[model samples]
Target: MEEKKFQPYIPADKVVPEFTVFSVILGALLAVLFGGANAYLGLRVGMTVSASIPAAVISMGVIRFIFKRDSILENNMVQTIGSAGESLAAGAIFTMPALFMWAAEGLCDVPSMVEIGLIALCGGVLGIMMMIPLRSALIVKEHGTLGYPEGKACAEVLMAGEEGGAKASTVFWGLGIAAIYKFVADGLKLFPSEVDYTIDAYKGSGFGVDVLPALAGVGYICGPRISSYMFAGSTIAWFVLMPMIALFGSDLVIYPATMSVAELWADGGTWNLWSKFIRYIGAGALAAGGIISLIKSLPMIVRTFVAAFKDYGKGSAGVLRTEQDISMKVVLVVCLAIAVFMWLFPSIPVSFIGALIVLIFGFFFATVSSRMVGLIGSSNNPVSGMAIATLLIATIILKATGSTGASGMVGAIAIGSVICIIAAIAGDTSQDLKTGFLLGATPKKQQYGELIGVCVSAVAIGAILYLLNAAWGFGSEELGAPQAMMMKMVIEGVMGGEMPWALVFTGVFIAVAIEILGLPVLPVAIGIYLPIHLNAGIMLGGLVRLFVEKRKYASEKEKNDSIQSGILYTSGMIAGEGVVGILLAVFAVLNINTDISGIISLGNIGGLAFFAVLLASIIFFCNKGKKAAKN
Candidate 1:
């Protein structure tokens, strides 16, 4: 006889109190809180923590310990709905801030709240709808092969809590430590979170790192391969490309750059060169990688749709809980309606062509995102990379068709915003579905919860974006909005009529070469795009993970257990800093200064010391996890 498949913790026929009134209300509130926190964090650092596990932990504490509720499904529903906030915020922050930056430059009027709200809402809804069809194919069909690490870990947390055997203290400890650290570093300005050093011998070359908890957490979750790829990109740009440009262009006045290289260097430093040229190469590489990735997945896409349609035709009524999804008819109709609205929306610049792009690219990235997170987890998903690709293609098409200047840029950003959110939400939804699958909750109910979360989070995200821009303008040193900067640069380059096509094409060819060598191009290209400092921080996290992995374990189970615990701690750390980051932004907006005169302020030295301390703490946590596994 063939071996049996693993069964869910709860049987399909069993009824549970899920999607209850209390669950919806609590989930909505958490969604708003987490969404706002993520918005603040993303703007400050171009990243957002995964809210699922953190939200699940908090929900369990409140529902089980405080409220005396006993339903695991109810707790699951809360997290499903609440985590949408982070995903939606990530997508919006990556693209929407460009509008605000352009407005500050007098390129166009600031996008109104209604416009922002609609774009995010539509994207979120579309993402959920798009994932509905893929649910059966990816989540159910490939269940064993694709572990969906975060989703499975979340289910484990929920189950352990229900059995009164969960360990949440690690998460709590990380949260407390990170929050206080961020407040001291960022709020009070005790020392810079980012530390840097310029190499006198290498003219334009320099080295630096952001010693923030979230970046480290992201690095650890991404593991060595992806992190290494990113770091490699950074090394190429900072070490090789920067020096080459400084040497060759020292006497030349590059186009789109008004000053000669030597003059620009004396005035603005190496960053001037990176921004004007290196980032174009990075964008080109990222765009090429995205297109290549999309092309490679086309077979999988065709297979998924075929399987989805066949499954839908068989009917889902009274089906097993693990297999059911939102009706295919409803998903199709809703997607169509949203596409129509995008075309008709006055503020959205694209006409029918824009709507078509949204539908096509939105679904394409959504498919890639869901599958990717299944393999790598949400923290590692390259949503911005995909957005970079979309913005490039959209801007090029618009500019070619005579939609130049501010209008073309807005249109490109709008299309990119939708696709970005769609990918983010789709990834989040798939993760939730995986959690539900393992826990034996209703897929349809989880799908509905995702929709509710998206709607509420969309409103909160629009408000938060506007507030952050008002407090400290995007593109300001205060809030770099790095991803938004990249998007804006692409639009300006394409439509503003002075794009550095040579640099961009160089990047594209470089990515092509990398792909031809059978290497992943997106992460490497992104490393090229982002500042070396950020990649250094991420690499440090990856190194820590490598250290943990190098140690011997009694068994694979023990190894997995140790890594899981480390993940939990890091997840908490990311959340802690994010919450504190938001509060700091609020203070800035309220005109409240938080400088403490007597506290230590050793500048870069202080940053290095703090970074060492943070690294030590990570080692401690990893070692503790190993010990716990042995026990």
Candidate 2:
């Protein structure tokens, strides 16, 4: 047997046009578009897919073909900068929405635009700065061992474009289709974006599916296993837990619920029961899953920390262009500056002690996140789980110091938000670095591109977030903001004495048992946490993927093309819906007449019919992708 040796597609000494003005502008624009799209999707569905591949495709189309730029390095740089927006958006949406939720509840004033932007800016810079030091150890030393699947796939897309062999139109096709679909469904209100059914006999038992293109794309991209795990969790929550509560606890009044279980059922339906009670259980599971994942990664985390410091103070002056990164000294200075900002910013709500937690956990999670994404793709990286753990610890520290109430909760979320962004961006940086390494691009240049994306994205994300909230509020039916809700619960549980510990502990043990069964717990826990309809929509997409994979193909290339086409199309769907969703939010804030519900009134039955049509369209597109790949 022969051992396969590692080789980069491009030689290390080779240089090509990379850091161009066109690349930076295009990438920055993409970052805003994708970031805005993802902010909408994550706020609605609690999951955000990677933008690297889609950005690569779009870069190829506009930068290579349209502008006649023949540089693969330029295309790579475009994706590197563009994808940072999605990564930063992911981190921000996961935790920052809690502020809006709190404001709605009258606990605190809504976080100002400046406050939001600064928090995102600080976190984005820290992530890029932290990942620069670990580049050699993770992206270089661990090369073939850690596949960095998304990065490699992105590189392949760039290379294909350079050779004039890449198919970029599928992405645009899906994007256009989905944008129109979203406008019809959400903007004109032709059919409800979500369709639900309630069982009259089984009081609290209800089922629903969000008929949105972005979620369907998410499911197909995530595939059967992960989607099923999530759906299973949703099933357990809706089918078993909610029903049991309705059966036995009918006479009892839940703490969070203002009335008896029966009365709550009549007033708010199944969603109220899950939000007030079952959501805490999901939070417990989420927290436990995060801790378990952290403990499991302890050895790796320790080794990473040791390796990082061993290279500390090492200058990049004499390194090869491809291996060059920002110096350790600059990283240290910037990190210290961020720490001072966190402590000094009154809007941040962090004291010296809180600042210390951000420093310690921020770097720690950054390392873990970057490496973990290398092993498993970013989609499965569990950034939210890590954020949960951070919030738990930070809230505890603040509570122990007597910083309790709304202020304390806000501070804890602020700290967690920065850490979340750090972890998310670090993972994204690692992936981009991997892509650069394979393509023989300058690491330092790419790092700068990432920073550029972050700055541009941070400015835009605050406005996007405020727009979405102003349009439909975070916790409303339109934008559930599930992950932020979990963070809010965790902080409240720690600071306030009104937490539902029984349900939470039940969720914790359930997660433990699931892990004992040798399953990935985070997805399942999230599935349980999210509404059944959302999970069901994702499950439909996963099933489409399963159907595609199960079929026989003429050759491996053909099979791969089919899968690639499905991914490209789905990515477009996510982006398309996101763009339109943001636009609809704008129209909403302007108080435009969007209620076409009466004119096109489908009601629930029509919604269910339209949802089936939506599912069928996904299957059709996937199969069409397979055929296109075969051709």
Candidate 3:
């Protein structure tokens, strides 16, 4: 018996305005906006938010309210394009900033903007092209099985376009509120965005939260389970490990720390301890988590790849519009062309061997990336861990081939960067395609939209990277760039650079213990890697979600509607804060001091008050959803 076909919201016979100039222009603007914003967030906190839903909501608000247009396809196109910026930025930030860090130490020249653009472009294009062949298998064939949470949520958002700004109000309110909050805390210097208190009784310990709106937004989006795991990791690091070090190694000078534990604690407190010691431990755990995740994903990755090829050309161009994809032959040729380009591109540092590695590893990981996002979501996909795994092997391979010193390290990072972008883009592309599939969008057009986004974002990202570095050095307090730092250390470690090995190994064992205990390693590892304050903020957000969920609902529909509203609201908060963050970076680069706090400074108490109001807003919108559901 034949399986019943899955019908989409827009039927194949239906036609609407899509791929319009307006959509392209809007998408381009959003691509730059979200791309730069995510880059800022990634550099600052070593975390980022997805742009798909935000883009969708904003597009809908404009199309339905501003322009009086009612085309869902056009709105979908905007998000498809806009979201690409975020994915590519994620990949680049995870690896490319290492070059900037290395240059700061005079290990090599600062990566030229052209060099940055070329690398990013190569990765972005390759990620899209590599994942194109898998759309049918991963998206259509595996439909109900995959779920693609964010994609489905995005589709629902587009579906809600008929209701106009009624739904978009949550997003708008969130955007406006968060932007004001960020400007007040960071710009006006009314208060510090990050608030902390040292625990006197618990020496070498502290409790704090970055009072910025985005961290709470992230917690709401990521939810309590993952947030709790991260909080747990941070808890152990700040409360358990730091005090232990202070107690046992009080008089001893650690290898990485020039001063004794007591002196370091006195000098910069627990923060100083974290910078010198906890970072390496976190790096090890992050590396271990990436490998564990990849190892666990191996069978599914292989299955996804095989299934993709087995159904490669099915339902593509020759079939219904809803099923149409770029021609397989075209996808193959473009992929090959990109490979050749990588080899010939001097700035990229890839040889013929390097190009082959790019194609092989690029597609392999792209496959893993797509499948992993399908089962889970893009947020949980550990592209950094994969990059670490790639760098370790790529570095050794490059070293064995006599590419040593600065040249070899650069070459290895180049390889890792492309693969990292490929994985990131692949996951993002899969999500976008899943949304398209559900909404009856043309795969070919969505693919083109993604390409446009990548190209535009690839160009803009270079400038953003340069601007941020000029404002605050990569490893500075303002821009920690943890993933990039990890990438740098991994490459340097392979190349015999100075490092504290014991601490790193201890982190590796910690990750192993986490896995043995059947807990998720990556988030826990990330928690350990980050400052406790940031984790605490995220925990607070998670607590709000817990509150929303714990309440008795009139019905499941009311509950879901309420939760959805909070998600949209928080999504806006992340983007709003991120945009302001990049703006502040721009101000810093221009030597324009935006701080007026000297006159109107709000202390920690005020910052706490603002954060409370921000969380309350999420609940308010959630309650609005309950009302909407009742209606």
lDDT of all predictions: 0.82, 0.80, 0.82
TM-score of each: 0.87, 0.80, 0.84
Candidate 3 ranges beyond 4 A from true positions: 1-13, 32-66, 93-113, 132-162, 252-259, 315-333, 356-389, 434-440, 460-490, 578-592, 627-631
Q: Where in model 1 is the C-alpha error above 4 Å?
A: 1-14, 37-50, 97-111, 136-166, 345-347, 371-385, 437-440, 460-486, 554-560, 590-592, 629-631
Number of the top-ranking candidate, with TM-score as the measure: 1
Task: Give me the displacement of residue 366 in model 1, in angstroms.
Answer: 2.1
Better of 1 and 3 by TM-score: 1
Quote the lDDT for 104 in model 2.
85
User: In terms of lDDT, which candidate is stronger, 2 or 3?
Assistant: 3
Task: Kindly list the per-residue Cα lDDT of model 1 for residues 1-631, writing each as its tens digit.
Answer: 1112757878888898998999999999988887887787787777777888778878888999999999999999999999998899999999999999888889899999889989999999999999988776678777865556568767866776676433466666777888888888887778888897878798989899998887787677667777798899889899998889899999998865789988888887778888777877887887777678778867776787787677777888766766778878789999999999989879666668888889988888887788777755786577887887788778888788877778888989999999999999999999999999888899999999999999999888878888878878898888899889878877787676667788878889989998998888767877887788888988898898898888889988788878877776776676677567656755654668898735667698888899889877877887777788888
Say which prediction, candidate 2 or candidate 3, comes out ahead on TM-score.
3
Weakest ten-residue segment in model 2 by summed lDDT? 1-10
Model 2 agreement with the true structure over 1-631: per-residue lDDT tens digits: 0112445666666777899999999999999987887888788878776788768877887877798878899989999999999999999999999999899899999998889999999999999998886776677766756666567656655664565423445666667888888888888888888898888887789998888887777777667877798899999999999999999999999776769999988888898888788877876787677667667766655675565555544665555666666766778889999999889978677789988898888877887777667754575566887787688778889888988888899889999999999999999999898888878888889999999999999999989999999888999998999889878877887787766668878889999999999998767887777688888987888898898888888888777777777776666676577557656644544557777788667776776776677667666666666677666
Residue 269 local lDDT, model 3: 92
Q: Candidate 2's C-alpha lDDT?
A: 0.80
Better of 1 and 2 by TM-score: 1
Candidate 3, 1-631: lDDT as tens digits? 1113888888987988889999999999998887887887788878666778778877887988899898899999999999999899999999999999888888888998988888899899989988887786678767866666567767766775554476656766777798889888988899988888899798989888889887787677667887798899999899998999888999999876778999998999988888788877876787777668768856655675565555554535356777667766677888899889889977777878778888887887787678666644575566886787678778878888888999888888889999999999999999999989988898889999999999999999999999889988899998899889878877887788455778878899999999999998877887887788888998898899999999999999999999988987776676576556666755654568988987887788988998998899899999999999999
